[model samples]
Target: MPRSALISALLLASLSLSLNARAETDPWANYDKVLKTLPKDAAATLDRGVSCNHFSGEINGDNSAADKQTFREMKKLKCGTVDQDIASVKNKYKNNKAVVNAIQVYYEN
Candidate 1:
């Protein structure tokens, strides 16, 4: 391969390796970031509400961390997931960017 192509390939490989290592160390890091800066009021509400979720909003924490693929994992987790387009969600978290796609609370009695 040409020198330029070899450099590009190495860079790509290193980046992929770094990402894989990060994920393995903290499988729930993305979720943590999305939930990290929740305002006291909303966080409290979530803890108290019968059903709660952060259905839709952009995440500005770490671009590489929040991704479309994460949605699949979100669903598989022991947490409720909801459609991102719900009006209640939109209105509730209109300006918040740290919101995850969805995370409905399933309180166990």
Candidate 2:
């Protein structure tokens, strides 16, 4: 390959790696910072969702319009996307009522 083509390929590879890394990061991972912005009930619900499994399953699907909007709002609040944020929260709280509480908190807040 020509030197210019090699440089271009390298640049593309670098950009792809960076984007993938960023995408892998949970958007709602920073909820702790925004926890203060949430109401007592909302905060509690989030805590609950962090502990539950059922709600977390629903969250994984794209059907929750309210949840989607909540995810969008979370981004503005620096909370990131809900789908990304819920993965670990689900794992951490799987089977716990906290999942329901968290989803409620996410939508209500």
Candidate 3:
């Protein structure tokens, strides 16, 4: 191959590797990608529950009273439908072990 072609191929390979590494590191992103392969309604329901349950701790690493209150409020708002969503997804994909396992691993509360 020509020198330019070799460089272009190397760059493409590097980009592909980097994207794969990122997907491996970010479980949420990888789960979303997997969910996209499912039916729209199932994916939407599962994604909603996953998004509701997923959150990071405060940056300061303190579990203050304010943080606890905020978390409780958020749980009431966002987690109200989580159980239903999980059940719906489980029923919809029960025949597919891969889908069920994905839900168990990534989306369950």
Q: Pick the candidate with the highest TM-score.
A: 3
Instruction: Provide TM-scores for the models.
Output: 0.28, 0.31, 0.52
The residue-level lDDT of candidate 1 at 69 comes to 40
State which candidate, 1 or 3, has the greater TM-score: 3
lDDT of 3 by residue, 1-109 (tens): 9999999999999999999999788776767578877778777767666666654333234777877765776576466777787797788789978678777777753
Whole-structure CA lDDT of model 2: 0.56
TM-score of 1: 0.28
Model 2 TM-score, 2 decimals: 0.31
Arranged by lDDT, best first: 3, 2, 1
For candidate 3, the per-residue lDDT at 1 reads: 100
Q: lDDT scores for all predictions?
A: 0.47, 0.56, 0.73
How much is 75 displaced in model 3, in angstroms?
Answer: 8.1
Per-residue CA lDDT of model 2 for 1-109, tens digit only, reads 9999999999999999998888666445555655555556545546544433334444645547967865554445444344445555545666656454545455433
